[model samples]
Target chain A: MSATEEQVDHIKQAVERWNAGPVAKLLAKFPEQRAKFVTASDRQVERLYAPEAATIDRYAEKLGLPGEYPFTRGVQPTMYRGRFWTMRQYAGFATAEESNQRYRYLLEQGTTGLSVAFDLPTQIGYDSDDPMAAGEVGKVGVAIDSLADMETLLDGIPLDRISTSMTINATAAVLLAMYIAVGEKQGVPPEKLNGTIQNDILKEYIARGTYRFPPGPSLRLISDIFAYCTEKVPNFNTISISGYHIREAGSTAAQEIGFTLADAICYVDTALQAGLKVDDFAPRLAFFFAAHSDLFEEAAKFRAARRLYARIMKERFGAVNPKSLMLRFHTQTGGVTLTAQQPDNNVVRVTIQALAAVLGGTQSLHTNSKDEAMALPTEESVTVALRTQQLIAYESGVTNTVDPLAGSFYVEKLTDDLEVEAEGIIKLIDARGGMVAAIEQGFVQKQIEESAYRYGQSIDNGERVIVGVNKFTGDEPPTINLFEVPESTTQRQLDKLRGVRASRDVARVEAALAAVKQAAVGSENLMPPILAAVRAYATVGEICSTLAGVFGEFSESTN
Target chain B: MNAAVKPRILIGKPGLDGHDRGAKYVAQILRDAGFEVIYTGIRRSPEQIVDTAVQEDVAAIGLSLLSGAHLALFTRVLELLHDRGADDIVVFGGGTIPPKDIPRLKEMGVAEVFTPGTPARQIVAAIDDCLLHHSVM
Candidate 1:
């Protein structure tokens, strides 16, 4: 379906005429924003895209009907026409009790799902009372040390009624176990459980550094969860391989998809090697991506990721399940784009980013609060963020049709370019012996570092305009009151941890942790012992420390 | 004083926050600015930070945190440095610290607190001034 030379010459003549006529006149009168229009990834955006610019020579081959093979238009047959995306605002801070209150408030305010944010201690598998957890008990997100905290965190949330997404990695096994224990107490069976655990640890080694164990054990734990979830929690999304953190870590959109999919390949390869059928696990595999401010590029990124992943699942993995080929993803608005200087501007930024996610056909979305750049968003800010999504869903009328921007010349061209670029990067990663080896060799980190450095330089050099920071400078001090975690939160969490230790059957906890250690030592699935430990009220640190003793802690080699 | 003896700086993350882009950028910029910088990577405890500061024999310590635990973590680093009688090492802060906390941080013996959007050159200059003032004193 390649373009004919005659058609290419004809389109070229028309483009040259238009460029020399109206475009030149307009440029003489009013200059463009930049000399050369480029996306955040540094890809040049042509002034105009026509038939020749787009890569889809045969529409049926590149983008078939929606919900068909190579689902470039979208994953679902009726995206948003059937139902709006699940509005899941990521929120947590202070304590489980406090975070639970926030969750209830959001649910009442029309949030369709829950996305939990764990504090540093909870994320890295430390108890609230551990010396490492000292000032950070519940500052960033909710602190879930044991089943007690998990139960409190999800006290009134009906497990069967709503979907939950836990942004937990490294210690995803422990958190998922605690969640299951909580669900069991709520009278919900494992098969009825529905949620996603961000169990992708390769990104932890590459971008976000919350890893507890080495790569070998981390992949094993992930494989164990994949096996466990396929058998037990059939409806649950086992692993949300994430590019959100990678994007936040300053990777380009293509790198975000490339590195994330490369990690996905590693996970799927590991699962297959461990004897799990591709269809059994691939359907439940989900992705998490960041919706940055670039509206069209972000939308195209989503489309390209879907098309690329569909091809990978079908051609590479020999997946027969149609559901396995669909790249269902949850998107969170970019937090790094929120400016601290003019905090109010973040509302508009978040609105645009959320709209991009909607147009990109996200399965679920989390709009960041305006005040996040300053501090944890206040309730008012969070409500505004949620309302932004609602406005897009109901009032915007973009949801009336599926893949509204699918055939636009610019979008189609960008989507094709993104797919090719990302596929090229993935090929390089494959050549480097998969994502883990590449990460160990600092390939991924170096790419992200160079991109981050370039982005910063662009901002510094005035090539990239950050509205409030660079162009529209303002000196008004922020008047919004930030949500502050009280200093006593640490002490209160410590007291609660002490109380749990006193009340729990210490012998049972010890036995459960010992079993967890034994499981870590052997090739047995670590989920059962971890679940047993969580049920016995063993703390996160206790379980992780046992595994740490066996698997050993990862000391990153600094470049 | 030997001109060849570069002023070594220890860049430490003294809490559970894993956002190290700012710290890493600062480390690279400082290294380019002719300072030997040792980054303690992410999620280092305050004790570990202080120990690294001592072991590296750095003239200044730059602490970066985005997890909103700056007050407690910075206070612990300062206290530990005092405890170890290494208070001569200049301490500065970076990463998402609110403007209101900047004064308090400075009052608590932090030489400066570099917030978001701060250029690498500004940080390098601040470190240079701190080192120069420390040598004179």
Candidate 2:
């Protein structure tokens, strides 16, 4: 046999000998040999990790980092050595003024950028005073009813100084407009304002349900933003095509990457079809992914995504710009991994996942709070989470080198394996017309559901052990200090909303809304008029309702 | 379906808490043990959830809340169901519920309060028991 064949033969012989010898001989040496093996019930079999067939070098050859094309070893030659990943934390709660304080706090604490979390009404396009906003105002995130809220949220924070990332997909254009209005008020030109908007709407239909318009109209709004952002905010990232929420909604690492990239592709194809050159906007396109407890898998996913995106941008789209070829991303550690049983364990999980993101070559990262499962993170808990990132960046020697696991046999092989698997999924999506069509057909959602089901089965069967959840039993579920939103914050927000409405000219708001409605129907970009409406103090709900009347709402397939 | 059969439970989130990890985990466990589950996505209004339960014709409705507005939100949902004459949907809850509030919640006609670390099997058995005692399936 050849050397490779000889190694395979040797492994087979060893497996056969182990199966037939030792314990077998010992069993034969005793009367209970057959009984010993038979007594072992089917229960243990369910917990075993044996695949139908074992590959050569489970961690070495196929999964190796550098050996793989589209290079998952660390997307670039110098990952952290050249520049540490951006520390972006999602922060926003209660009213605009309150959230602005938190935003400044996060920045003072060494956060590289800002990621805004809009409250329910704001996300669905409603003002705080709207009946729909009644019990929901500022419950989960900050309420931004008008440009006044946006101004307070961005108060004193220089738009040109620090990049801001907003997690608003449904009402992205309006929020983007508000962001621009803040930039204008600050005397900073739109081109100088840098940041990103989580404007990926397809994922909304598939995972997060904050969508307002039907798919076609949603695409039009998204494309409108894409066209406007490239021209107005040249440095700003238009859409953070996301798979992070998809994974948070119960998906595997592979599905997260596959589905997210599929969504990104959909956005790219849409923009390209909208008469924009691939190179013009592809460079500004960004991605957001979830970092789960799977260390190797998560790391492999980043590397795989980078490599896949590079090739797709170059070969598929025929993009010539080097920046367009690189898929810059922001990763948030999975909130689902945090267990309320022993919430402290979440610190360790976030730390590990954060390290994986850094090692995998993310452009930015967000480590979720340990107590997020229970409530909004307490200041103490948020500090601890922030410290987790600081410590990794400062103390961990892992950042000293570029692609620390670069030439490792196992990591390389795993990266390659992941790339191949993800590519296959992409091809499957391509055959079915792409992400938009695939999502409509329920392909992506079904895949995530299956993986989620399998994962749950494994956890229940003890194959996947969530510490303190399924394995270690805690006596008295330790008392966790949960953060409570102050009732006064709501009153303050409502007061502010009332004051802004009282001061702003209602006629101006009407004209702005009318202009927005006209732009929604025509080929004109919506951001400028939307900003005009925001400046006129039009409620977020009013602007969104206008678009809804034009675009319509989306009701998803239950299946 | 008779009370002897496994009581079908529809656990759901009735608002914009994109935190569905707990609900999804519970759904899988309930499904494996044989319970029909109807999951309403994030940002669902209280009325939508109640409408879904009545339409799906479920026996029990388990509202999961990680957002701290459980007291207000759940009460409104319950009140809506009562107003609509669908109060028969056995109401229960889970998710980040403080221990002190459990009794208050139970007093509000919530059949059970499942805190974190309560085993999946235990939840299944509890639902079964609650359905049998209440003579509703």
- In order, candidate lDDTs are 0.90, 0.78
DockQ for all models? 0.63, 0.43
Best of the candidates, DockQ: 1
Q: Comparing to the true complex, what docking class would candidate 1 get?
A: medium
Regions of model 1 farther than 4 Å from truth: A1-9, A20-33, A53-56, B1-6
Lowest-sum lDDT 10-residue window in model 2 chain A: A38-47
Task: Give the distance in Å from residue A135's predicted Cα in candidate 1 to where it truly belongs.
Answer: 0.7
Model 2: DockQ against the native?
Answer: 0.43
Error of 2 at A472 (Å): 1.2
lDDT of 2 by residue, B1-137 (tens): 34346656777787665556567778778877777777775556788888888888888888887666677678878888899898778888898776667888888888998876567788888887787777734
